[model samples]
Target: MDLVGNLYLPEDFDANKKYKAIVGASPFPQVKEQVLGTYGPEMAKRGFVFLAFDYLGMGDSPALAGEFKQSRYMFRLIENTWDAVSYLGTLPYVEEIYGLGVCQGGSIIASAAVTDHRIKKLATVSGMMAADPFQWTDKDVAHQMIAAANISAQKIYETGEPDYVAPFGLNDDQSKEEFVSAAAYPAMAGESYDYYGRDGFRGPKAVENFSNMHIGDQAMQSLFSLCEHYADKIVQPTLVVYGQDAPTAICSTAFIDRLTNDPEVSAFGGFSHVDFYYKPEAVEKSADTVAAFFNK
Candidate 1:
C-alpha cells in the first residue's frame, strides 16, 4: 500500500539548495499526530525537512490485510519505510535521509536501517527490543499477558478470521481498570487521559477505533522476531533514548550491546514511557538529541 505522509519543509526551504531529511515513524496504534507531529515541526524549525506518516492499517494510511498473513504487516512496515526514503530521495533538494522512531516505530526503523542505506543516522525513543519486558521484571504478569495474547492469536488462526479485540478490553474488569488508570499522566491517574484516549494527543481517534487498535497476532510475533534478528545488523550511528522509570528501559542495554558501533544511550531519570510522548522536557530533550545526532 502507498502510505501517506506530511513533509515539514524548513522555514527557509529552497528547492535548489540541498538539505538533509528525516523520516519519522509513529508509535504503535498512533498516526502522525502523536510524537511524530510534535517532533516533525520541531525539527523543521531547526532547519531540516521531516516526514511523518501512518503505518499500514493505522492513522491515515491504507488498511492491512483483513486476515493475518503471518509476518506480512511487520515486513510491510520496513518496505513502506524504504518507500518513504525513496520518495524523499527523489526530491531535488534532499541530500541525506535519517530516521527516528519511538516505541514500536523505533524497532521498525532499526529493522529498516540495517539493510537500507538511505537511513544515514538512527534514533529510537523507548524502543521495545523484545516482546517480553526486557528481563523477568514482571515474569508472572508478563506470562499472563503473553498467554492471553497467544489465546487471542489461536482464536484468529482457528476461526480463519482476524480477531478484532480492543487493546483495552471489557472482558477483564480488573485488567481494564488498570489499563484505564495507566492511560493518564503519571500523577493524574484516573483523573486525566491526555496522551492516548478520548480528545488525546492522537487527535479524534480513540483507543476503541478499530483502525488504531486492531492487530493480527502473527503480526505481533513477527515484530518481536524482527527486532531480535536485526538488532545487531544496523551499522549506522545510533542514539538510544529511554526513561529510567519506564518498563521498556530494561531492554536498552540489550539493544545497545548488539549495535556494531558505539551507540549513544540517553536516560531520563524521572521520566516514564508516556513522558517521552508529550511531556515538554522529554520531547525537547529527545528532539534536540536527535537533531544534533543527525546534523553530525
Candidate 2:
C-alpha cells in the first residue's frame, strides 16, 4: 500500500551534500499536517530532512484490503514506521536516519527503534509513552472500552463496514468550552480537546483528511501496546521532553524510568502537554532540543 508523506528539507538543502534525516510519527488520530507539520519544518530549518506521513487508513492513505479507514492498529503503525525508515534509505543524500515522535508517535518510534537499527536516535515531545495506565487506570472503564471494541470488531466482521467512534469523549459539534463545562472527560485526555475540538487552533476541519474518529475496534490493540515495558530493549540515544506540570508528564517520566540507557529529559515547568503541538515557544524549544540531540 502507498503511504502519503511530506519531506521537509533545509532552506539551504543541497543535493550534493549528505544530511541526516528524521522520520516523525504524529499524535493519536492526528494527520501528518497536525503536529508533524509544525515540527517537520522546524527540524528541517535546523538541518535535518524530516519526513512526516499518514499511516494506512488515515488522512490521504487508503486502508489495506479487508480493513476500513481510520484503523490505527498498534502493530501496523510500527510496520508503517519501518516502511518510512526504508523510504529514507532510498534518498541518496540521507545519512543516519533518526526518529522524532510526538505524543503517541513517541511510543511508536520507541517501539520501532527497539529492533530497527535504521533509526539511529530517538526523541519524543509530550509523549503518551505508557498508554496502559491511561486506559487501564479504572478497571470498570477498561472493561467498558474492551466491550465496546469487541462489539465493534464483531460488527465489522459481520457487516464489513467500519464503525467509527470519537476516541475522545467530545463530539465534533461540541466546543472545547462545552466539553470542559460539562466535565465530559475528567482524565488527562480532556486537555486534547483544546487542540482537536472544532474550536481548537487547528481542529479536524482545519487539517484536511483529519477526523477525530477512529475504527472502534482499534481500542483492542491500542490498549495493549505497553511501550515502557520494552524501553529497556531500545538502545538508541533517546530524548524525552514534556511539560513538567502537565498531567501527562508521567508518560515521559514512566518511559524514562524503564529506559536502560540514559535519556535526556526536558520537563519544562511552564509548558503543558498540548503546548508542544502549536505553541511557538514550546514547539521551538522542543524542536531545537531534539535537533541538537539528534545532531549531537
Candidate 3:
C-alpha cells in the first residue's frame, strides 16, 4: 500500500547494518510534512529512520469525504499509523521500532503501543489524558461536538458531500478573538499568526461539517476511554516529554505522570515538551534525552 506521508532514511542506512526506526505522528489538523519534516532529517542523521504522514482526511492523504464519523476516522488514522510502523519493521535495515507522537498523535501512539508488541519504545510530546479536551473549561463543547458529528454524518448520508468549516477559532483574518497563551493554543501550532509566512501551514478546518470535532470534552472522554481500556496493557519503555512554558505544559506533565504511574508502563521518563518541538536549546536537550532513551 502507498503510504500517505514522507519517510526519511538515515544517512548511514545500510541493509547489512540494521538500525532503529522512529515513527512520528503529527498532531490533529497538521500534515505529516510539517511536523515530521521539521525534525526527521535531524533524527535521521542520528541513525534513526523517521516516518511522518497525514491523517486520513487531512493533507495529501485520501480524504474520508463522507464515509465515517470523527470517532471512526480516528480509528482509521491509528490503523494507518500502525501500518506505517509495520512497513518500517519489515525493512531489512530496521533493527527495532519506536514511536513518538505530538498532541493527539501522542495519545494515538500510547494506544497503539499498548496493543502492538512490535513497538519497543514510546514517547509523547504534549500528550493529553483528560476526560475531555474542553473539560478544563466550563463550555458545553461536548454537546456541540456530538451534535455536529451527528449533523455532519446525516448531511453526508443525505448529500454524499462534505461541507468544511473552521474547526476552532475563526479564520485568521476573520476573527477578533485574542489568542491566549494556553496549552491548546500552542499545541495548535502556537497561534496562526506565526504560521502566516510558512509555505503550506494554514488555519484549522472541519471537513465534512465536522466543526465540533476537537471539542475538549469529547476529546477528553474519548482519550480516557482508551486509556482505561489500554493503559494497563502498555509494556513498552515510555517517555513523556512536555515544555514548562508551552501552553499545554501542565496538561502534558499531568499526562506523563499518569502514564508513569500506571502499572503497565515498565520504565518511563519525562522531558520538557516545548523544548523538543521549537526551541534550539530545548530541542537539543530533548534530542539527547530521546536518543539516550531509545539507544538504551
Candidates sorted by lDDT, best first: 2, 1, 3
In angstroms, give how far residue 36 of model 1 lies from its true place.
1.0
Which model scores highest in lDDT? 2
Better of 1 and 2 by TM-score: 2
Query: Which pairs of residues clash in candidate 1, taking residues 3 or more apart in a chain or in different chains?
Result: none
- How badly does each model clash, as a count of residue pairs? 0, 0, 15
Assess every candidate by TM-score: 0.81, 0.96, 0.76
1-296 in candidate 1: lDDT tens per residue? 67778899999789999999999876665667667888888889889999997766665676656554212256777888989999999999999999988877887888889899889998988887544445345677556656767887888778877665445331212232465655534443322244654455443344332233454453344425366557677778899999887766766657777777788888888887778887889888888988888888
Is candidate 1 or 3 superior in lDDT?
Answer: 1
> lDDT of all predictions, in order shown?
0.71, 0.87, 0.59
After superposition, the stretches of candidate 1 with alpha carbons farther than 4 Å from their true spots are: 64-72, 130-162, 168-192, 203-212, 216-219, 222-225
Model 3, stretches more than 4 Å misplaced? 64-72, 131-139, 170-192, 196-225, 260-276
lDDT of 3 by residue, 1-296 (tens): 35476778887567798888898876655666555666677678777888877666555665554343223255765788788888887888888999988667777787777678798898776665332432435456655665665675566567765544445543433332344342355544444433321221333332222222332222323434354245546778887666655545555555555554342121123434434554456555556667777898
Candidate number that wins on lDDT, 1 or 2: 2
lDDT of 2 at 236: 89
Best by TM-score: 2
